[model samples]
Target: MRKIIMLLCLLLFLTAAYSYPQSIQAYTAPLTADEQHVLEQSLSIHEIDREIARIESQQNETERSISELSEQLEGKNEQIKDIREQAGARLRAYYMGEREDLLAALLSVGSLRDFISVLDYYELIMDRDRTVLNNYKTEYADLKKTKTKLESVSAELTQIKTNLQLQRNRVAALQEQVDTTLGHSTDPEKLMAMIEELTKYWENIGLYEVRRYFRALSTAMSDFSDFLDDHKDSLVSEKGGYRLEVREEDINAFLRDKNERLQDVSFEFGQDKIIVHGSREGLRLEVEGHYTVENEPENSITFHVDRLFINGFELPDTTRKELEEDFDLGFYPKKIVPFVEATEVDIAQGTLTVKLKLSF
Candidate 1:
């Protein structure tokens, strides 16, 4: 039953994701061009500084809010305590005499009106007591909400700072190596070795690459959507479901560009997603889906999307980790970097192509 309920919730969530205006695409390439290389280095530094400053400011604000909320809650408790203390003192004085004596004192009032006034005052005290308790309750509820929000924001900022810090360290180390290598006279062997080392470092630092790749893929998805809008009637059937047909040649180009082995591969539009089922080398990834949704294309369009599932099974563990980190880091995953960006996109004979390696 738990599994069923969870599955229902997941379905609802995916339906919403599908309904949003977004697109998903994947590509990979080695960095080329001296300008691009320089920019990547500069971008890495800028990203690190921006992220650090952002994380620090956000965490400080969240911490301050939590502290303020704590003090306010404590103040409410003090107010309740004072009310209780006053009530206790009143009870102590009235109850000092025996029950009969206390009744006689009340009966010895100056007049019926005076007795009635005393009763009304006692009722007023009781009302004040109830109001104080309710105030405490209300303050507690507000505090809980504030604290929860603070924790979430703080955790997110901390994680982002940590991730950015890691990237910053990596870039700094690489920058040092680059500077040292450049300082020396031109040596092809040393340059080659440096390149190899950098490549290995990039692969090991999986999160950074994953972040950039997804950003590029997202931009491509948007361009693909614009292409679709121009040819929407061609893809959408009268039955309401969409069909995007890609020829084998198109798949071949994708494989050549991405360096994916194409044996045991298939492509088609599956339900509300683009399905890419193939074995890359011997990894045997199957049942991958891609889709594009039209958000406002008037100015700059924004897309919110997910890869959904991979292979015939589910997405690999790394994908989930990246997403969780993104949440914890308080980074807007795609908006800051689209998965794909293109100056000009052209489709020929059912093959989709775009200019690659754009700077954000």
Candidate 2:
């Protein structure tokens, strides 16, 4: 007990001036997406199909948008024409002969009340023309803007179709190459099996990613715990626990300080789970997991994979389960054990809160 107290005192003395990250900073992800990297690394039939399907989906949506915009543009043009004609008719009526009749009617009024009524009627006619012109101006402006956007959308659809055609050409080229190399003797079933096997291989990689992410979390929590020890007074006391809350940004700060390779890595703490995403070396990966703390003999944090996505494609459930079972990325905040143990870890949006109990 005396030696344990001496160690704790020495640790506090050594870390008393340590400062936790207080300001938020962002580290930009790499420009190239992981999907592109995968394609570059292995130009397989599966990748080509995935690319084609994506472009085709975009093509269909663009066509629908163009159809809708065409209808709207037609209606707007008709509306502007009607408003312009109405306003023009009123102007022409006054210019041709109505002005003289209106002046004569005002002059012939028998009393002040009659004169006032005639003036009110003239004013009403002018206001109606003015309102019509305003409506025309507004609608005409909108019509022009819509026409411009339609042109851009049409161009986009053209590009999408062009890309689809290019993919078609690519598929033909790859198929021809394979046939030539294999003397057209390779079994069709074998080729298909190869694609399936390749996909399964990629899925296994998801487990590696899950392990890497969990390890990162472990190191981040360990660093944060060290900081917490220096400022234990700031912990909020609840009915049966003491809680420490932190933002993803601060966690990021700690990670960044630990390794320059972690520049693009970022985290999101959600309810009962965490989302990690980043791009590096022309690859992007995202993983989410629900974490639980263990305190049977030693306090440590561990998690089970809920979802894993690489380049926007989610890993299969079989792969996710494998990820959950594979590695131990548990974080043990050994320094804090002498004072308190973490009991409940909760997440909300961008914040992480760890509830603790005094370790007696």
Candidate 3:
């Protein structure tokens, strides 16, 4: 059977990331000016910051989209007008059963050096209205749809900006409240108690679940190392080292069986790095990173997180480094099989290869 006991433990723990619980009786108070009589402590600064960043990114993207769509929509109308004008002025008499007038007008329109030159479908049809208007109808519909999309995205951008402003005001209010509370209180003990309550809010918001998620990832890595050790005796050896290649499909199957924790995330193998992206708890999460050989010539290789994002909020370098070091998803093969050390790790296309060598 697959080793999922510890992995499941991680999964079960991480699912509670949004709501941090404690044995202490929870604070009871009104949440905000809008939410009256709700029994809860104030929202954490970290949560508000994340929300603002996510909304701001969305607003920027929407503005760019609206600009591009407006330009396209503007040019589309002119294109349709030109194509129709060229078709009517040059080819209208052809379907009118007047060959002489058709030939004269077609020849007179500067050798039909207009939309006819652009479209170049003159020889393909006698029904100019049907052929040229075919393109017109499609272009017109696309132009209309572009208008609709532009309007929608513009509205969305407005709402995103509004939300961002509201979040900013909340942060300001929070700061003002904290400052006022600290200014009035002369007792050091009461101030420390108030600071501790805020700390609790920060710890409970989402940090606990994030750590649990990392542990689950670590457990999966350890299990893979154990698998390689158990099968080392029967594995093929080349160039004095053993190589194991696990494909993306293989990893997905293994993870699904090993731990159901990261159900929302999917992993892709790049030339040298692993790409992870998915929607988690209504936020888009993206991670790009790779593993490198142990720096101290040890038995393990460590995962170095290059980039991480939630919605569009990037994790700070300091916090990212802390997470990477604290929950390093490393494989220590020597601990499992004596003298065997992981020498190299690389990701290519759909596969992740680990090369192990016996050093002693």
Which candidate tops lDDT? 2
Better of 2 and 3 by lDDT: 2
Model 1 score (lDDT): 0.44
Ranking by lDDT: 2, 3, 1
**lDDT agreement with native, every candidate:** 0.44, 0.65, 0.63
Candidate 1 ranges beyond 4 A from true positions = 1-39, 70-77, 83-126, 184-360
Worst lDDT 10-window in candidate 3: 33-42
| TM-score of predicted structure 2 | 0.46
TM-score-sorted candidate list, best first: 2, 3, 1
Candidate 3 deviant stretches above 4 angstroms: 1-206, 229-235, 295-297
Which tens-of-lDDT digit does each residue in 49-115 have in candidate 1? 5555655676677677767767766676666566656656555655685434645666789999988
> How would you encode candidate 2's per-residue C-alpha lDDT over 8-82 as one tens digit per residue?
998874353121110000111232343233322233454566668878999999999999999999999888888
lDDT of 2: 0.65
